[model samples]
Target: MHRQFADLRARFLARKYRTERGHEFACYGFSRRLGTMVRAIDVVFEKLPPELDTIPDRDTVVDATLMIQAFVLNAFGCLDNLAWIWVCEKPVLNARGKELGPLEVGLGPKRRDVRASFSKEFVAYLEKRQDWVDKHLKGFRDSLAHRIPLYIPPYIVSPRLSKSTTSSKKPVEMPSESLTWGSTTSCRPSSADWASGGLG
Candidate 1:
């Protein structure tokens, strides 16, 4: 997957599409990548066993959590880039009649423009979940980008024993163990949510 994405990115860069369309293409590419990552995370999570004894090893849990964090960070970055492109990629004239680039528009104006230009449904969704974006996604992204030590709490699993006439064996009783990722707990959305065109 890494190599495939690298090749795709290389091909994209080689074309050197620097126009407004290019920005849109870039946004599309990033969105696809984000979707892929989300799917991969979902697959990993699904592979986790429901039985405590049948749970995957610690390494697997760590890797899965890391992938989740990666997805969250990438989603935030991709969306931000897309918003910037939508808001500021257009050519603007300055006082001296010079064409201002995207970066020249400044962050504040770019954000306002993005909000104003976005679809009504998208704008409403953002308005409703602004706190989640700021607190969970943005906070996690910042912590990751700055290399801050994050506290990853363990995933507690309590597997319920099934009742079947074929098997009379009692379910093994085991205490829940904390699967540490680091300083932070797992912050993953439901896989079904992604499949239904939610955050992914």
Candidate 2:
């Protein structure tokens, strides 16, 4: 949050912070969840190996996986809680015919209510974020929560690569590797693009 916003938030509390208005307190709730996400990630970093190829002990693996799940859930929670901030800023959004919940705020044909409820600029911002979430976060989070739990494979090896590479005693890596570079908007994303913080 910006310093100006922090100052304004204090002013809002001094003036309009009422027990009945749920949104007034939502900013704090959002803050706490964001903090949890950060803490969970830090805990994961401490508990798990930094290198992908280095496996943790079985007990540590279980603990770290739980922390990762916490991190992911809290990230989405922070997003959802922003809707409450909107409700506080624009009370009409929660008025009779336009009640918008946190989960209800999104951009899509099916989410026309969300587009209609927020400003055009806000919807445009949401479009980009939703795309990123769909591509990166949703599948992993959903799978961990609802389907198969997150799996940290010991290693990756395709059948064809295994046959040729395993013949020698040396380790076999790069089962499937392709290197490419172009404008991010035109190219498929790769680790090389994100690790140094470009594509994202």
Candidate 3:
């Protein structure tokens, strides 16, 4: 991954490319990173139990949840960086009629400038998904990045008792435990959405 990123940076910085080529480079980078995130999410889900209730082990549940969250955060980070690149790839006219590139624009303007720099179709798509993004993805990312305390409920454990051969023997019943992460909800974007919007 590091080597891939190094190659991308080298390509992006190559002097032979014109302005349009720069945008293509940014789009290529976004597609590659998005593919990485999708593969990661797939792997994480594959390790998870078929059903949440089937996870009898507490440690396994905790580890799985953490791993999922980590991947989610990474995916969001990739989107945010792509947005920055999309907005900053070209020069924009300033209030004083001066042309400003990414260095002059900085990160502060990227968020607001994205809507203008990005395509109308993409902007509309973002508007449609604004609520989901804000409530689920952005909120979760902010919480993790800021080191905010997450309310992880105690893991619910259900124990299965072995069958006894003796007529007098009885199996012990174990109480089931459940874990909740407060009222927080998560949003998982589909590959189509990523391809359409992130790639666009």
Best by TM-score: 2
Select the stronger candidate by TM-score from 2 and 3. Answer: 2
Q: List the residue pairs that clash in candidate 3.
A: 156-177, 156-178
CA displacement after TM-score superposition, residue 70 of candidate 1 (Å): 1.3
Rank order (by TM-score, best first): 2, 3, 1
- Predicted structure 3, TM vs. truth: 0.52
Lowest summed lDDT across 10 adjacent residues in model 1 is found at 191-200
| Clash pairs (backbone) in predicted model 2 | none
Candidate 3 regions off by >4 Å? 1-32, 52-59, 96-110, 147-154, 157-200
Worst 10 residues of 3 by lDDT: 158-167
In model 1, which runs have C-alpha deviations exceeding 4 angstroms?
1-21, 24-29, 47-55, 88-125, 147-200
In order, candidate lDDTs are 0.52, 0.53, 0.50
Q: What is the alpha-carbon lDDT of model 3 when measured against the actual structure?
A: 0.50
Question: Judged by lDDT against the true structure, how good is candidate 2?
Answer: 0.53
State candidate 2's TM-score.
Answer: 0.59
C-alpha root-mean-square deviation, each candidate = 10.2, 9.6, 10.0
